[model samples]
Target: MPVANRIPILCLGLLLATTSCERPAPPTTAEASDSYNLAAYIEQQQERLQAEKPMVLKSVTTEEKPTETIQTAEIDWEDELSVFAETDLNRPALQEYYTREERVLPDGNIVLEYNRVEDAEPLVHYLRLEMTPDRVLRQLNALIQDQNILFYSRRNIQLTADPSSGNISGYRVQGVQKLVLSDSLHYQIDANL
Candidate 1:
C-alpha cells in the first residue's frame, strides 16, 4: 500500500476505538425519575378546586307590590258628616242645619247650645257647651270626656265653643258626642233638641 493511504486508514481506526472505550455516567437522584405523573396530578387538582368552591343556584325570581293613594278633593262633605259636625258651629254650613242659643248662668259661666233640625247619622242632635275659662282643663275635662249621669241623665249636652262668636267648637271632639250611656236617653234628649 502507498504511505499516504496507510496513514488515513490508521487515523480512522484510532477514532472508532477511543469512542467505543468510554462509558456513560450514572444518573443522579434528581434525574433518576424523569417521567412525570402529569395527568393524575391535574385530575387531583381539579377535584380539590371543586370541593373548595361555593355552591351556586341555577335560577332565581323576584316580585314587587303595587300601592294606591286617594286625593283629598275627591272626598264628599255629606259623607264626612260625623267629622264636619265635630268642628266649630259658627261655620254657616253647619249652623244652617241647626238652631243655636247662648246663655250666661248666675255663676259667671257661659253656656252655648245647638240643636239639629235635620237628621244626620253618627252626629249629635243636641250640643250644650259650658265655658269656665278660669278653670283648669283637668277639672273641665271629665264633663266633656265622660257622660255625666246627672247631666246626661235627662237631656243634656256639654259643649265647647268659640268665646267671641258663641259658636260651638271642639273639646277633644267638636259639638255633642254620639256615644251616650243609653240610646233611649239620647232619644229623650233628641226630643228636646
Candidate 2:
C-alpha cells in the first residue's frame, strides 16, 4: 500500500483501539461491606433539603465571642451537613480498618457502632447510629480526631432525625483545635432544620 494509504489505516486502527478500551468503574458506597452506606444517606439528605429550602435556625459559639443565632431560608445544606458526610466510613480503603457491631435495645431500637481496630488510628475514631426496628434512622454520632506536630483537632458531630420521616431535625458540631504558637480554640455549632 502507498504511504498515504497506510497512514490512514494506522490512524483508524489507533482510534478503534482507544475507543474500545474499558475504563474501570468507580467504587460504590455499598462495596465496602454489609455496612450502612453513610455517604449515600447524606447525599439523599442533601438533595431533599436543597429541594425543600427549609428555614434553618443556627447558633454558633466560639471562644472569641458569645453565641450568635441566625434564622433564614438561605441554607447551605451541603455545608451544613458536611460533617456528617465526611464521617462516612464505607470507602473501599476503610473496609478492613474497623469493625461494626449491631444490637437491639429493649425499646426495640437498633443500634450500630463502628470502632477502629486495635492498632489503627483512623480519622473517625468512633461512629454510632440509632435506628428504628424497621431501619429508620433516628440519630448519628461520630468522633473525628487528627493530630500532628503542627496542629491537633478533634470534632464531635451529631445528627438527629425524625424516625418516621428520616428528615434531619437538628445537628451539632463541637470541636477544639490547637495549632503551634496559638492558643487552643473551641467552637460549637447547633442548628435546626
Candidate 3:
C-alpha cells in the first residue's frame, strides 16, 4: 500500500485499538468489601473538619527530658489526621493481608479489630475501631511502625470521636524513634479538635 493510503488505515486502526478496551471502574466511596471503608471514612472526616475549621488545643511533648508545648489555633484537619489516614487498610492490595474480627460489648458498643496475618509486616501492625451500637464511630486506634538498618520508629495513634455527633473530639500520637547512631527520641502529641 502507498504511504498516503496507509495513513488513513493506520489512523483507523489506532482509533479502533484505543476504543476497544474499557477503563476499569474506579472504586466507589462506599466500596463494598470485607474490610471497613477506612480510606473513605477518613476522607469524610477530613472533609467535614476542613469545612468546619474548628479551633484545636494541641499539646506536644518530646525528648527524654520532656519539654511540653501547647497551642490553640485552627489546623488543617487533612494534614493533622493524615497519620490516621495512613493506617487505612481498605486498599485492594491489603484486602487479603489483614484479618478482621468483630465483637459486641455488653455495654452495647461494637468493636472491630484488624490484625495482620502471620508473617505479614504491614506498616500499620494493628487497628481497632470502637463504635456505638447505632454504628457511630467512637474511637480508632492503630499501631504504626517502620524500621530499617538506619532508623526505627513506632507510634501508637488514637482518635476519639463523639458518638452522637460523630465529630472528632481529640487525638493522641505517642511514639519513639531511634537512629542508627543517635539516641532514641520520645514524643507525644495530644490534640483536642
What are the Cα lDDT values of the candidates? 0.37, 0.87, 0.84
Instruction: Quote the positional error of residue 90 for candidate 2 in Å.
Output: 1.7
1-193, model 3: which lDDT tens digit per residue?
Answer: 7899999999999999988775544445443344456677789989998887777878888875655656655677788889999988766666567887889999999898989899888899999999988778899999999999999999999999999987789999999999999999889999886
lDDT of 1: 0.37
Q: Give me the runs in candidate 1 sitting further than 4 Å from their true place.
A: 1-87, 118-122, 133-193
In candidate 2, residue 86 scores what lDDT? 78
Whose TM-score is greatest here?
2
Tens digits of per-residue lDDT, candidate 2, 134-156, equal 87889999999999999999999
lDDT of 1 at 75: 22
- In Å, residue 153's CA in model 1 sits off its true spot by 20
Off by over 4 Å in 2: 1-33
> Which runs of model 3 end up more than 4 angstroms from their true locations?
1-34
TM-score of each: 0.27, 0.81, 0.79
Residue-level lDDT tens digits of model 1 in 117-153: 7554213455554555432111111112234443332
- Candidate No. with top lDDT: 2
* Candidates 2 and 3 compared by TM-score, better number: 2
lDDT of 1 at 97: 62
